[model samples]
Target: MIKNFSKLALAAGVSAAIALPASALAEIRIGIAGPQTGPVAQYGDMQFSGARMAIERINAEGGVNGEMLEAVEVDDVCDPKQAVTVANRLVNEGVSFVVGHLCSSSTQPASDIYEDEGILMITPASTSPEITARGYELVFRTIGLDSMQGPVAANHLISLEPKRVAVIHDKQQYGEGIATSVRDTLEEADVNVVMFEGITAGDKDFSSLVTKLKQADVDYVYYGGYHPELGLILRQARQADLDATFMGPEGVGNKDINTIAGDAAEGLLVTLPPSFDEKEVNQALVKAFEEKGEDPSGPFVLTSYTAVQLIAEGIEQAGSTDPFEVAEALREGSFETPIGMVSYDEKGDMESFEFVVYEWHADGSKTAVN
Candidate 1:
C-alpha cells in the first residue's frame, strides 16, 4: 500500500508538470509588423527575415536577462487602417517592443497607437521626417530621413547638368514629400525644372508621362516613389526611345526593379542608405543569411537587423523589458550593431547617418558611386 501511494504521487507530479502551460517558461516578446502580403511585401520580407535572424542569434547565445526572446509578427499590408489593427493586436499580445511598419503610410498611423500604449516602436525603413518630428517619445527609426536624402538626390541631378529636369511623384505622403523637397532644392539651385507631376501609385501605364518627358526634352528625370512605378516608367521610357537619365530616392532601389524594367533598370541612379553588405564585419551575417536561402542584401535587411539588436541591447542595459525603461536606456546609451555604432538624439533620430548614391547594373546589382 505504501509503494502504491508513492507511485500515485509521482504520477500526479508528472501529470501536473506536463499540464503546465507553455507561457510559464517566461519570454520577452517583441512584435514585428509590416506588409507581409501586399505590393510592398518584399520590404516586409527583408524586415522580418532580419528580425528573425537576430532573435535566433540572441536566444541561442542566452537571451537578455535570462528571459528567452520571442518574435510576434503581424501583417499590416502597408495600409493605414490595417496598421492600426495590427498595432492593437500587438498591444493585446503584451508586446512591449516593436520593430516595423515599413511603409511611411502605415508607420504614421501605427505610431499613434504605440505612443498611446507606451510601447516602443523603432522602424527600420520609414523615412518621412514627420515620423521623428511628431514629438513621440516612444517612436524611433534606424534609417535616415527623406529630408536628408532629398538634397543629396537634388545635388546629384544638378551635377549631371541636364538640359531640363523633370520631377514626378506617386502622390503618397512619402513620395510627395521627397519630390517636393527635391523640386524645391533644384529650384533654389537655379536649375530649370521644366515639368512637375503626380501619378497614382498602382497605375500600370506611364506612357503619358513618358510622352511629357520627351516633349519637354528632359535629360534627367527624378522620381520620388517605390520601385514598381519607377520600373514601369523606365521600361516605357526605353520603349519610347526617350534616352533620358533616371534618378530616384531610396524607394526605387529594390532589386525587383530589375524584373520590372528588365535591361532598362541599368544605369538607374538612386540615393540610398550606405550599403552595409559591403562592410567586412557583415560578411558572416551575409553568409548566415545565404545559408538559410535568404538574401541579406535587401535595402531594409541591415537596418531591420540593427533595430532588433537595439531592442535586445536596450533590454539588457535596462535589465527589464518594460517599454519605458527600454526607451530610456536606448536614448541614454550608444549601441554597436551590424550597421555600425548608433546613437540617438532626444527626438529618437540617429545623431549621424549617411546616404550614398549607387548605380544599378544590368545584372540586378548596384555599385556604390565614388
Candidate 2:
C-alpha cells in the first residue's frame, strides 16, 4: 500500500525514538523502494516479493549478525520526482541498504541521493548504463545494462536478415536509451533501419504509427518502452494489418501486454534476463513462491532476491553494518545467487550478464528462442 511521505516521516520518527537504545536496535532495515502504485506496479510486486521472501528466509535461518531484518517500503510511483522524495524518506528512516527504484529514470536520480547520503542501493530491474557510469560506490544493480541487452536484441534481429527495420521508443530514458542502443548496434551490423520514431508513453491510439510502419514495409519493428504503450501499438499494428514482427526489451515483456494485445502478443519477441526460475538450483525457491501464490518467473523476482541476499552477505563479510564497508564487500566478493554467480566491476555493473531472446505467448508464458 502507498503511504504519504509526511505520514511515513512521522512514523519513522516515532519508531526511531522507541528503538534508540542499543538493546532495542535488533533490526537491519532494508529500504524497498519502487512503484507501489503506478503503471508499472506489477514489476514492483516482483521486486517486493523477492526482497521480502529473502528477508524472511534469511531471518528464519538466523538473523543477520543476530539482528532480524526489517523492510521499509516506499512507493516512488516510477516518477523521477517522487523517487527523490522517497529516497529522502529512506534516509530519514535510517535504511542502510535499498533494493529498488525499478525504472532507470527513477533509479538514476534516487541513486544520486543514496550516494550522497551513504545508503547502499542495488536495483534489480533498471538497465540504463548511466546509473553505474557515475562511479558511485553505493550504487549497484542485479541486472544487465542496455549496452548488453541492446546488442543481444540487435544481433538476434540481424540473424533474421530482415530487409528493413523500424525502431520505436516512448521517449523516456529507459525506453529511448535502449532503443538508441539497438539502433546503433543494428546500424553497425549494416542493417537498414527504415525508421526510428518516438511515441508518448501513455498514448493509446497508434494508428498513425501503424500507417508509418506499414508504409515503411519494415520486416521487423523494435520498440523500446514499457508494456502499456507497446501493447496498444502491437494490437493496433496488427489491426492495421501491418505484418512486421514486433520486438522489445524487458520493460515490455510483461504479461499484462497480453491483455492489451491479445493474440498479437504471441508473436512479439522480447529480450529479457534468462529464466532463473527454470534453473535446477532455483526450483525449491520457485516452489516457495508458488506456495505463496506469487509468480517467480517475472524477470526481476530472483534478481531482487539476489540483491537482498548480496546485501546481507556483504554486511556479514564486511563484519559491519556500514554502507561503505558493505559496498566494498560487494565489489570485492563474488556471490552465488539465484540469477547466477555475480561479481561487480569497478562501476558496480555485473562483470558478466546475458540477455536471452524469448517468444512471448498470449497466455503470458515465454519460450526462449533457440
Best by lDDT: 2
| 268-318: candidate 1 lDDT, tens digit per residue | 999988879879999999998999999888879989989988999998999
RMSD of each: 3.3, 6.0
Among all candidates shown, the one with the greatest TM-score = 2
| Candidate 1 runs further than 4 Å off | 1-25
**Residue 132 CA error for candidate 2 (Å)?**
0.6
Cα deviation at 147, candidate 2, in Å, is: 0.1
lDDT of each: 0.91, 0.94
Predicted structure 2, TM vs. truth: 0.94
TM-score per model over all chains: 0.93, 0.94
lDDT for 14 in candidate 2 is 88
- In model 2, the worst 10-residue window by lDDT is 17-26
Candidate 1, 17: how far from true, in Å?
Answer: 12
Candidate 2, position 250, lDDT = 96
Candidate 2 residue pairs that clash? none
Q: How far off is residue 34 in model 2, in Å?
A: 0.7
